[model samples]
Target chain A: EDQVTQSPEALRLQEGESSSLNCSYTVSGLRGLFWYRQDPGKGPEFLFTLYSAGEEKEKERLKATLTKKESFLHITAPKPEDSATYLCAVLRISEGGSNYKLTFGKGTLLTVNP
Target chain B: GAGVSQSPSNKVTEKGKDVELRCDPISGHTALYWYRQSLGQGLEFLIYFQGNSAPDKSGLPSDRFSAERTGGSVSTLTIQRTQQEDSAVYLCASTSGPSYNEQFFGPGTRLTVL
Candidate 1:
């Protein structure tokens, strides 16, 4: 069974603090790994897509890195406005073919206190 | 340009009732997806439609959940005989194409079943 597990279900940090969120997966064949930020009462917003091992993507204060079995989202100097649930998902190839459906993790709820 | 959009930001209905949620993807996006997010749970894929091809409904939890993409644009997800367990946020997303593309999501519709 394909599973995506995100660690640290909830994290509270002071403004300007940096931390990393982990998303480990066990899948048949990984096609891509995705990161998203979701605010309360809103749908998730796309962040980055890592297609292969050693790939890293960045925007603003967020950086995402991927490996063979897991992915990490590193936040640098996060602010209060950056507080949101960080989600990780994976697309894997199944017996039928490359499945476009995403298997998501139980996102990490990050709270940045000012 | 506008991103994906969903109607009835919130819906409250009694158990055994039926409800329909709607989604309008971005212009020119050929792939549309529907997912459900339960409280404290990961997002679960429900269905996918790409171009004029038949929708992939493998992830749908039960027969009561059905979705349709009309004219390769607007999509609707219908839940029949809703139950208490059916209460969740129904999210819609879209991509230009299927392969490893970042999916843009809409502000989800919060469904409450009493």
Candidate 2:
């Protein structure tokens, strides 16, 4: 079974404060790693995809890096609007074929106070 | 719509009632996915539909939970004899194609079971 775990169930940060959220995973054969941001009462928005170790992607205030066992989402000088839940998912190819299904983590809830 | 959309943004029903949540995927997206988000449970994959093939329903928790995608455009998730455990936000997303693609999300439907 594919499993994903995230750290810091809840995080509180002031405006301009930087922080990082961690996501660790264990899967049979990894196809990809994904990051998503979700606001209250809304669906998750895709942020980035890390295909291999030592890979990183940046979007405005969010940056995601991946290693062999875990991925990190770094927020730089975040604003109040950046406060939301961050989710990580992994793609595991099925035993027989490449079935498209993502195993998701419990997510890290981040609150940025202005 | 430019993004995925779900109907009945909020629903409140009795424990034994049946409810159907609807999802409209992006115009040209070929891959659609369903997920559930509960407090502390994070995001759980419920099902996935690609084209006209058999949906990947491995994530569905029970036989009472079922879903269908018609014409490869819109999808509906049905829950029979709703239970308190079924109370959560049902999220839907669509991607252009392939599991590696970025999936766009919809504003989920919040289901509250009494």
C-alpha local distance difference test of each model: 0.93, 0.92
Give TM-scores of chain A for all candidates. 0.96, 0.97
Candidate 2 lDDT over B1-114, as tens digits, reads 578889999999999999999999999999999999898897888998988888889889999999999999999999999999999999999999976798899999999999
**lDDT, candidate 1, B1-114, per-residue tens:** 998999999999999999999999999999999999999999998998989888889989999999998888999999999999999999999999884899999999999999
- The residue-by-residue lDDT of candidate 1 on A83-104, one tens digit each, is 9999999997656774565899
lDDT of candidate 2 at residue B108, scale 0 to 100: 94
**Candidate of highest lDDT:** 1
Give the CAPRI class of candidate 1: high
Model 1 ranges with Cα > 4 A deviation: none
Candidate 1: the clashing residue pairs are none
- Each candidate structure's count of clashing pairs: 0, 0
lDDT (Cα, 0-100) at B56 in candidate 2: 89
